[model samples]
Target: MTVVYKLNVFKDPEQLNQNVFAAQYAVRGPLAVRAEELRAQLKEKPDSLPFTEIINANIGNPHQMGQIPLTFIRQVLALCQYPALIENAEITQKLFPSDAIARAKELLEETGGIGAYSSSQGVPLVRRDVARFIEERDGFPSDPNHIFLTTGATQAVRMMINLLIARPYHGILLPIPQYPLYTASMALYGGRTVPYYLNEETNWSVSVEELQRAYDAGTAEGTEIRAVVFINPGNPTGSCLNEKAIEDILGFAKRNGVIVIADEVYQANVYDLPFVSFKKVLSRLQTENPNDAWDKVSLISIHSVSKGQLGECGQRGGYMEVTNIPEAAFKQIYKLASIDVCPPVAGQFIVDILVRPPKLGDPSHDLYHKQIKDVHEQLFKQCRQLHSALSSMKYVKCQEPRGAMYLHPRIFFPKKLIETAKAQGAEPDELYCMELLESTGICILPGSGFGQKENEFHIRTTFLAQGEEYLKHYVAGHNKIMEKYE
Candidate 1:
C-alpha cells in the first residue's frame, strides 16, 4: 500500500503549532514588528522621516530613546569593552573612583578579559559587590553566595518560577495588572497564574484583605500556592507600595506558607516616600513575630539595571538574591541557571556598576553626582509631564506615578467596544491600540495581555520618548481615542 503525506499548510491552523508556550509567548502581537519596520525605514532616509521622530513605545529602552547613559557608567563600561580606554587621556575624566578603579582593574586582572565566561554563578568579586549593595539598600547583611547574576531579571525570574512549579495544579500569585514577564514565564513553564486584583482606586496597592481572599481561594481548592509576586514601584502602574501594605503582605505570606517574590527593578526611582524592601519588612517582622516566620517564608527578590537611574535596558543585567531558601531548593534553582552556562559577561559588569557606585571622596564622586542628578531629573520631569498629560484626559483615569516610567490608565469605552473589536477579529484593547498605531505611529501594550480584570481596559506606554513633540503627539492621539470612548 502506498502512503501519502500532507504538508502542514494543509493542516488545521491550531494543529500546526506545537506547545502551548509558542502560543502564550505569541501574546505580544505586532507592535514590536511595526516599531522595528518604522525604525528601519527611517534609517533608509534619515532626513525625510516625518518630524525627525519615530517613537518606540514598545520597550523601556532609555538609551535608544535618547536618554543618555550615566557618564560614570558608560565611562567604566567603555573601559571594560576596550581596556585601552584606561590609558586614553580623553576618556579618563574622573568617572571611576580610586576604589572603583582598583576594583575594576583587579577584576580585569583576575579574569584576564571580559570575553571569558564567568563562573556559573557570576564572578565572585562582582557577586560580593552585589551583596554589599543589597546590604546597604536594606540595612541588613547580604550573603554573596545567594546572588545569581542572569542575563537580566527576566532569566532570574524564570529560574525562580521554575523552582516554584509543583506541577500544573500549583500556581504563582501576582497582581492582575502585572508586568507580562510574570504571566509569560508562568505560561511557558507549565505553571498556573493566580491573579489578585490591584486597587486602581487606591493607586494600585495590595490590600491585606485582597491577599487573604486570593490565597484562601487558591489554597482551598488544594492549589499548591507556591509564591506571591509583587512589583514594588510597579511596572504598568507606577504606584509605590506603602509601609503598612508591605507589612501586611509579609504577614500574609508568613501565615499562608508561600514564597514571597519581589521585582524591585525600580527601587531607586521612588518620588514621594522612601522606597522600602520586603527585606526591610522581613527584618522588622522578625522582631515581633520572633518565630522566624518571615525568614522561613522562602523569599527571592529580583533586581535589574534596566530601571531607575541606571535604566540599562540594553545591558540586560540583573540579579536574583535567594534568601532563607531551603538547601535543596537553592541548589535546584542554581542548577537551572547553570543550564544556560551563565549570563553575558558584559552584563555582569553592569550589575557590578549598579552595586558599586562611587562613594564620597572617590575620584568619580563629583562627576557621578552630576551625571546621576541630570539623568534622574530628566526622568523625574518626564514622569511628571506624562502623568499630568494622562490625568487631563476625561476618559483616562491614571494614578500619579511614584516610581518607574509608565502610566496605566483604565480607559472608558462602550459596552459594545469589545464586541465591535471581535467583529473586527481582534482583542478590544488590541483594536484600540492598533488604531492608535496605524493613525499616529504610536505603539503601546494593551492591558488585556498584561492580565487585567475580565471587563476592564487599559494601555501601558513609557515616558522615555524624547522632547515635547512625541509626548504631545501621544497625548493628542489619545484625546482622539478618548473622544471615541466618550
Candidate 2:
C-alpha cells in the first residue's frame, strides 16, 4: 500500500492571513506588474507594442524616471561603505572632496560600519542631527529621544498605525483618495478606516466639518478614532494645506483626543505655495493658547529622502518626530522599533547627509546647489506641461498641483463606456487606464484605486518622466479613447 501525502497548508489562500491578502496597494498593483511584463516582452520581440518603450508614469520614483543622483551624497556614502578608500589617503583625496571624506569619517566612527546594526532607534549622532534639522525647520525644539530613524516614512507610518490600532474596532480617520499606504496599513493592523472626503472642486481643500462628521460616524459605529492622517502637498491630489488648514486640523485633534500623523515627505516639492510643517503649526498653537492644553495634542511628523531632490528611494532614509506622546506609549513605540533590530545602516548614513548638506563655500557646495536647482526647475516645468496636456484633452479636467510629483485628473467617461465597464465588473477609470497602457505603453494608475466619489472617474500619474514626445503619444491615445467611447 502506498502512503498519501497532504498538500502544503499555505497552498490554499484561505489558510493564510486574510488581512495580508485583502490589502491593496495600487501604486505597484496589477497594472504596474503588467507594465513590467510588457517591458520584458518588448525586450524580446522589439515590436510587441505600438509604442517603442514603456513610460512609467505610475509611481513617483524620480531616479527611475532619469533623475541624476547628487554627487556629494554618493561620494560620502562610498567612503562610508569602504573605509579602505579613506585609508588610501592620496588616491581617495584626489577622487573625493575633503569635506566628503571628513564627513564619511565622522559617520563611520558613529555607525561602526555600513554592514553593522545601528541602535534600534538609530545612531545617536544621526538622531541628534535629525533633531537639529527639525528644530531649525519648524522653529521649535525637538528631542532626539523622540526621533525614530525609519526605513522610510512608510515604516514610520506603519509603526504608528501598529501602535494605535490596539483593537479590531479601533479606527483612524483617513482622507479619501489618499496614498494607499495609509489604507493598506490600517487594513494590515486590523483597524477601521473612517474616510473623510476632500473637496475636489475647491482645490482638494480639507474641511473641518467633514473631519467632524467622519469622526462622529465612526464613534457612532463603536469605533475608537485613534488618529487622523494629513498628506500635505498631497500624494495623488497634490493640494498643499495652508497654515489655517493646519491650525484647524490641530484644533480638531486636540478637541477629539486623537493623534495627528502628518505625512510631509513632499515638503521639499512645493511649487505654488510655501510648505509648512505641522510641527510649526502645533508649536504656534501651544504658545498662543498657553492654558488651553494644546500640549495635550499628540503628533507624529514624518519626512523622507525618497521624494525630494535626493530621490534616493532605494536608499530608504526617513525619520519621525513624535510630540506630546505619553511616556508609557513612547517606550512601547521604542520597543516596537527594537523588535525590528534596526533600520539599514546605509539608510541611516543617507539620513545624516540629508539633514546636514554642504554649505556655502564648501568644496562640493556649488555643484550640489546647482544640481538641486536644476532638478527643482525641471520638475516644476514638467508639472506645468503635463497639466496643460491633460486639461486640453476632450473630457479631462485637471487641477494644477501645488506641490508633490503626481497629478490626479478627473475624467468624464461617456455613458456607453461606463456601462461597458460595469459589464466587465471594473471601474470606468480602471478599464480606461488598462486600454491606455496597452495602446500607448504608458502606465498610469486609475482614480478608483485611490478612492473616489460614486459615479465619477479619475486617474493619477507622476510628471517625473522626462521629454515631450511620450506626452504627445499620451494625449493622442487619450483623445482617441474618448472619441471611440463617445
Candidate 3:
C-alpha cells in the first residue's frame, strides 16, 4: 500500500511567506534525538544488558550529571517560589547570604509582595546589581539602565541580533570552531554568519592576522559586518585568551565599525590558569583608543549565572550589558526587550543574589563560601584530570581545558574504520562516535556537531561524569573502543 502526502500548502499565500524556522535543520541532528529514544528503551532493560555503561556527555548540563548547585542562588529561588518561606528563619537565612536579605526585605516593604510582575524592562534593583558587578569587574562605571536581564544569555543574544539585522545582507562575524547557538540563531533570524578561523595550532586561540583576513574577505564580499562575537575561554575548543589577542580584536572592532559581542559565560571556569574577562581587556584597550568614547566601537557582553559557581543550569539566570552603545541604538534594543515583558522573577532574584552576596561574618557567608569553594575546586580539578588523562592517550591530542568543562580530543581515524563508517552511510565523525556509544553506552557529541575543520574527526565529552565511578567508566569505555578501531 502506498501512502501519499500532499505538498499543496506552499501554494497558499500565508504558507508561502510564513515559516522561516522550518528551513533551519541543524537543530534536528539524528544522533541527539536518536539518543533520547535509545535511552528510553535502555531504561526498561536490565542492568545485565549488553551495554557496559551509560555516560552522557552529549549536552552540557552539569547538574544532570550530578553536580551540586550553590546554596545561595537556590535558597532565594525557593523563597521566591513560595513566599511563606520568608517567615521561616532557617529558610530566610539560606535564601539570602546578607545583602540579599536586606534588599529583598526592602523590595517587599516597597512592593508589599513579589507576587506582582516587575517592570517591563526588568527589576531596577536587579539590573542595578548586574551593573555594579560589571563595573567592579572592569573598573568602569556601568549604567543600570543599560542592563537588560533575560531568562538566559541566549535570549539576549537573539534580541541583539534582531536589532543588528535590518536587511537581508546583514552579517555577523563568528569564529570557525564556534558555538552552535550563534550560527543557529543567525540562521533563524535571517542573517549571514562570516566565520573566522581560530589558530588551532596555537591551542585554538584567535590571531590578529586571521581576524584581519576574515574581516577583509567579508567586507570585500559586500557583506556588512555589524558585529564580531568572541567566546573568551572559548566553548568546546576550551582555549583561554591572552591579553595581546584581546587587544588586537578590540582594535579590529574599533577600525571596522563592528560591535563586539563578548560571550563570557565561562569567565570563572579557568582551571590551571586564570581566565581574563573581555570587560577588563576592553577597559584597558579603551584607554589606548582614548579619543573614542562609545562610537569608537560598541561592546555588548552576555553572561550567565547558569555557568561558573552558580551552575544552576535550570534556573536560567543571566544579564546582558551594552557598553558604549549610543542612546539611539539602545532605544531600539530597549523597545524590543520590553516586548518580552521581563525575565523570570525567580531567576532575577537568583541573579541578584549571585552578582551581590553577603560579606564575611554575615550569617550565610560561611556556608556560602564553604559550599562554593568546595564545588569550584572539585569541578576545576576534574577539568584538569580529564585533560591530562586524554592528552597522554595514543593518537588522541587534547589541550588542557583551561576554562570550560568540555575536552575535545582529535582522533586518529584508521583507514579501515573510515571505510566501514562510509559504507555504513553515516557522517565519519558520527559513525565513530555512535559505535563508541553503543559499545560503551557512553554518549558524546561529534566535533562536526559544533563547527570544526573539514576532514577532521573529533569528539567532545564533559568531565561531569558522576564522580569517580563514571569517570572510571569513561576512561575504560573510551580506551577499549578506541583501541579496537586503532
Candidate 4:
C-alpha cells in the first residue's frame, strides 16, 4: 500500500507571516553564518581556509573575543545557582568574598532560586535595585513599579514596537545606520520604517531637521508615526549623543506626539563623550517646564548587561524603565511580559549586580574596579588601533571612535567594484566584506545590512578582538580587495 504525503503546515513561505520573512538582522546575517561554516571547517582540518582562525568582528560580543568575566559577578552567580554552596560558610568564605556571599544571599531571598520563576514583571527587589541604579545615574527618582526586567533591551524594543504599531500604517523613525535590531523588529511587527540619516560629518549627530523631514515624509505616505528610536553611544557609528541632542529629540517627539525609545545598552561603553541618559534629560525638561507638554511625553529607556565592561551577552540581562506612559498602556505592557512568564532568573541576578556592585571597602571592590579599568583601557586601545588603520587605507574615511564597541568606516568603492556588484545584484560593501572574510577569516557586517546612503559603502566591525597582530592581516586583506576592485 502506498502512503499519501502531506504538505507541511507552513510549507509555503506565503502561508506564514510575511513580516517574519521581511525582518533582516545583518549582525548575524549571511556573512556571520558563512563564517560559522568556515569555523567548523577550520576545526576539522585546521587549515581549510587561508587564515588559521576566524576573527568575529561582526558583533559586539566581548566574552566571545576573550574579555574576562567579572570575578564578583561569576562568584555571586555560582552561589545563586547552587545555594547549598552558601550553606557551607567555612568553605564559602575561602572561595568567595564576603560581599559576594551576602549579595547572593539577598538575591536568592528575592528570587527564591535561580531555577524558580519570579514575578512576570521581575523580582521586586531586583526591580527596586534597577530603580535605584536609574535614580543615581540620572539624578532623579525612579519608580520600581514602572520598571520591567527583560531578556535584554531587544525584548523591550519588540514589546514597544508591537504595542505602538497597532495599525499597518504605523511607523517608527530609525537612524539610517541603525543597529539592525530596530529595523528587524519594525519589520517583524509590521511597521513602516522612517529613515533619518545621521550626520557623519559631525560624528553622526542627530539633526532635528532630519528628524522632521523623515517624520513628514513618513506622514505624507499615510504612516501613523508613533515612536522614534535612539541608540545612544551608537552601535555601528560609535557616536555618543550629547545632552542637548537628547533634549532636542525629546522636544521633537513631544511636538510630533510620538513616543521615545532610547536604547542605551552601551551606556557604560563611552570613551570620548560623556554618556547622557534620555531619562535624565527628559526629567530635567519636565522640571524646567512643569506646565509644558514635556510631562506628557512618553519615553522608554532601555539598558543591558550585555555590553559595557560586563560583556554578559549570553546572560540576557536587561531592564526598561517607562516614564509618562499611560496607565492603560502600562498595564498592557505588563500583560505582554506576563505571557512570556519571566526573563531568565540568572539574568535577573546579573542585572541586580550590575546596578548594585561591590562598594568601596567591600572585599570585592578592589578586584572589581581593577577588572573594569582594564577592560575599559583595552577597548579604548583597540578602537584607536583600528581607527588609525582605517584612516591610512586608500578611499576610506573613518570617524574617530567616540564610544560603543564597533567602528563603521565609510568606504568609497572604485567605480569598477560598483559596476561589478550591480551586475551581480549585490551591494558593493557586501562584496567587500565577503572578500575580506574569505581571504582573512575576519567576519564583519556590510553597511547595507544596517542601512546606508545610496551609492555609498561601509563595513561595521567591532574592535573587541584583542591584539594588534590581526590588524595587520585585516589591513592586508582590505588593501588586496581595494586594489583588485580598482
Candidate 5:
C-alpha cells in the first residue's frame, strides 16, 4: 500500500508532558511493583519463592493489613447505599443500629440520594458537619461555605498545589523524607520545591531557623515561595507538631506573605503528643493580635477519614477548610472543583458519618467507642514492637513513633553495601529494601524516595502489617543483609 498513517497523539513517553514523567511516588514505586510481581508469582507457582507471603509495609493502608472497619460506619454506609433497608422496619431493627439508621436517613434527605451528583463543593449538610467537627476540635468558629469535601486529602492537596503554582518558578516548602505526594504534586504542576529539613536528631521536629534558611535560599535562587506544607503527625516520620511549633509556622507564613497548607490527615493518629490544629493556632493569634495581619494569611487545613481509626481508605472521604483566603481566590478554587463535577457521592456520605458519629447514649455509641479504642491500642502496640525490633538491629536508629502509621528509621549501611548499591546505580537504602523484599517478601520504602540529607540512609515502613511473625522475619532478613555486606 502506498498510504502511510500519521502518528497518534502521545505515541510515546517523550511526546507526553515531561513533568508527569518526572513525578515519582516511592511508596508504590519499583519496590512495590516488584512486590506485586512476586505476589503474582506466588499465586501461580506456590513454592517458587522462599517466602510464602508478601508483607506490604510500604503504605499506611490499615484495612489491607486486617484492621476491621467500624461496624457503625459500615452500617450507616449500607443504609445510605440502599435506603430500602431503612424502610424495612424489621430488617432495620435487627441489622442496623438506631443511630446508623437515623444518620443515613438524614444524609439521604440532605443529599437527595447517593446516586445523584452533589454540589461541586460538597453536600451542604456534610460541609456543616465538617465545620462543626473543626469547631469542636480547634475551639474556633468554622464556616460551612468555606469547607470543600474531597475524594480524600490527596485531592484537596492537589487542588491547593494547582492554585498556589501559577508559574514554573513558584515554590512550595516541603519537609524532607516527606510523604512524596507533596513532591509529586509539585512536579506534576511545574512548581519548585524548597525542602526544609526536619531535625531528625530531635525526633523529627520542625525548626523555625531551618524554615527561614530554606526560604532565604529559595528566594535567593529566584524561587518565589508561594506556600508552606505542614504534615502534622507527619506521614513518614510520624512526629507530631506541638502548638508552639504550629504557631511559629503560622507566624513564618504571615511574614513571607505565603499560604499555609496544613496536611493534618493524621491528626487523630497521634500517640504521645496532643494534636493541635493550625486553624486553632491561627485563630488564637488573630484574636490576641487584633491589629496584626493574621487574618490576611491564607490557610488551607485538610483532614481525612482514611488514616484515623475509621481506616476507610477505600471510601476516599475527606474535607479541606479554607480560612483567610480572599474571595476572588476562593471563587477560583470553587471553579477548579466545579470542573471535576463532584467527588464520589458515597465518599461524601462517609465524610458526614466521620464528622458526626454516634453520640453518647446512642445504641451504637458503646460498640463504636470500643472498636476505636481497640484499633488505637493495637496500632500503639505494633508501633512499639516494630520500633523496638528496628532499634535492636545493628546500625539502625529507630525513632519511637509518636503518631501516624509509619516508622522512618535511619539505617547506617555498611560501607561495603554502599559500594554495592553504587555499583547497581541505586541508593544504599533502596538496595537494602530491595534485598529485604527479595529475601523476606516484606516490602518497604527507602528514604531516597522521600528526600534525605546527603550520606544519610533511612527506610519507611508502616506498622500496619498484621502479626508479630512478619516483624521477626523483617529483623532476620535485615540482619542477614547487614552481615552479608560486612
Candidate 6:
C-alpha cells in the first residue's frame, strides 16, 4: 500500500552539481565543524574534554568572542526595528539617546520604514552617504549610481566573479594564502584560480614579478586571465598594501586589460601602515596622466562593516564602488542585484550609519569616539600579545601583524609529524591543528586551507579571542604538540 519514491533526488553527493561538489572552503571547512561537535558534546558532558570551553580562534569574528557592539549603532538599530519606540516619549527619552532617535527618524523617513524592501540598488539616501564618504576618503568624486549595496563583501565578490568569468577557461589571479572566499567564488562560477604567492619574508608583501609570472603562466596554459583580486589588510596574512604597491597593481591591470577587484574590508584595521584605497591611487594616476589609458582600467573596490572597528558581522552590510565600468556592464550588475530583490533592509540601514556616523557637534560624538578608540586599541594590543607568544614557540616564525585580525605563522614540522600526517591522509599542518584542538579546545585553521608553498607549513589564528589566559593556553598547547613530535 506504500508508494516507493524512485531514486531519491539529491540523495547522493554525485546527484548535486559537480561544481558545488568540487568547491572547498577551508576556513569553516572541517575544523570548525569538529569544534561545533565538541561544543555540543561539552554541553552534555562537561568533563569530556581537557578544556571546559572551546576557544574559537579559527575565524575573525569579534562579537562571537566578546567584542561589544557600539552603543550608538545598537541604539539606532533598536528604534529602527520598532518605530513605535519613537512615538513613545517616555521610552524614547529614558531609553534612547537624542542622537539615536534623530538618526532613526531620519533613516526611517528616507527608507519608508525598515519593514519595506529598499530599491534593488539600495536606499538612494544611503548610496548618497556612501558617495560622500568615498569623496571624503579619496578626495575624488563618486556617483551614487556606481555604488551597489550588498548583504556583505562576500556577495559583492560573488557578483564580480560572475561578471568577469564569461567562459570556463577564464581565470582570476588570487594571492596564495588568499581569503578562501575568492577561491570559493571562482569555483562556484566555474572559473580558474591562478595563484600568485606573497613574499613571506618581507611581511607577506606582493611582488610584481610574481604577478607577471602567474599571469604569463595562465596565458600559456590557454586560460584567459580576466580579473585580479586583492585583499588589502589581507585576511590571513594580516598585511596591508602600501600606496606604491597598489599603484603598481593598478598599472599591471591597466597594461593587461584585467579587471581589478579590491577587497578593502579591513581598511580600518591597519596598525603599522596607513590604509590606502585602490580607488584613491587609481584616481591619482588618472588625474596625472590625462592623456594615458588610465581611464580604461575597470576596478571594483569593496568594503564592509564586518571587519572594521564597527565589528557588525551579523549585520551583513557592505558596498561595492565601481569605476570605469562600461554602461552595458553596469546594467548587467544591476540586473544581477535585481534578482535578489534587495539586500537586508536592516543591513542597508547599518551601511548608512557606517559611512556616516555622528559628526563632531553631534550628541553621541564623545561616547562614539571613545567606543571606537577602545576597540582599535584592544585589537592592536591583542595582536601584539599573540604575535609575541607565537614568535617564542620552537620552530615557529611569526610575522608581526600589520593589519586585519589574524596572525598566520609558519610552523616547521618534524619528519615524524609529516609521516603521521601522511599516514592519516592529511597535511602536516592539518594534523597539528587537529591535535591542538583535541588537546586544548583551541580551534585554528591550518595553512593548507589557505594555500601555502610546497613543503611550507603554517596555521592561521585570530587574535580576537580576549584575555592573556587563553593566549597562555594556546602557547602551552602548541609547545606540547611540538614536543610530542620532536
Q: Residue 255 error for model 5, in Å?
A: 1.0
* Total backbone collisions for each predicted model: 0, 0, 0, 0, 0, 0
lDDT of 3 by residue, 433-473 (tens): 77766766777877776777777877877777655555555
Error of 4 at 447 (Å): 0.4
lDDT of 5 by residue, 184-263 (tens): 99999999999999989999999989999999999999999999998999989999999889889888999988899999
Off by over 4 Å in 5: 1-4
Q: What is the C-alpha RMSD of each candidate to the true structure, in Å?
A: 3.5, 1.1, 3.9, 1.1, 1.1, 1.0
Whole-model Cα lDDT of every candidate shown, in order: 0.78, 0.92, 0.75, 0.92, 0.92, 0.92
Screening candidate 6 with a backbone cut-off below 3 angstroms (N, C-alpha, C), the clashing residue pairs are none
- Model 4 worst lDDT run, 10 consecutive residues: 9-18
Give the TM-score of each candidate. 0.90, 0.98, 0.90, 0.98, 0.98, 0.98
Q: Which clashing pairs does model 1 show?
A: none
Question: How well does candidate 1 match the true structure in TM-score terms?
Answer: 0.90
112-208 per-residue lDDT for model 6 (tens digits): 9899999999999999999999999999989999999999898899988988898999999999989998888888899999999999999999988
> Which digits, one per residue and each the tens of the lDDT, describe model 1 over residues 1-486?
899977766466666434243534322558767656766776887665443545667667788778777766776666777777567646554554455556567678756778888888888888999999888887888899999998888898888787778598879898988888888777777777888988898888889799889988887887788899999989878889977888888878888888899898888888887899887777667766776656787678888888877778777788988888988878888788889888887788878878887778877777777877887788888878877887876677887788887888888776666778889887788877876775567778788877788778888888877666666777777777656755
Poorly placed runs, candidate 3 (over 4 Å): 1-28, 88-104, 107-115, 292-295, 483-486
lDDT: worst 10-residue window of model 5: 7-16
- Between candidates 1 and 3, the TM-score winner: 1
Compose the digit string of candidate 4's lDDT tens values, residues 80-143: 9899999999999999989999999998887678999899999999999999988998899999
Pitting candidate 1 against candidate 4, the one with the higher lDDT is 4
| Candidate 3, residue 266: how far the Cα is off, in Å | 0.7
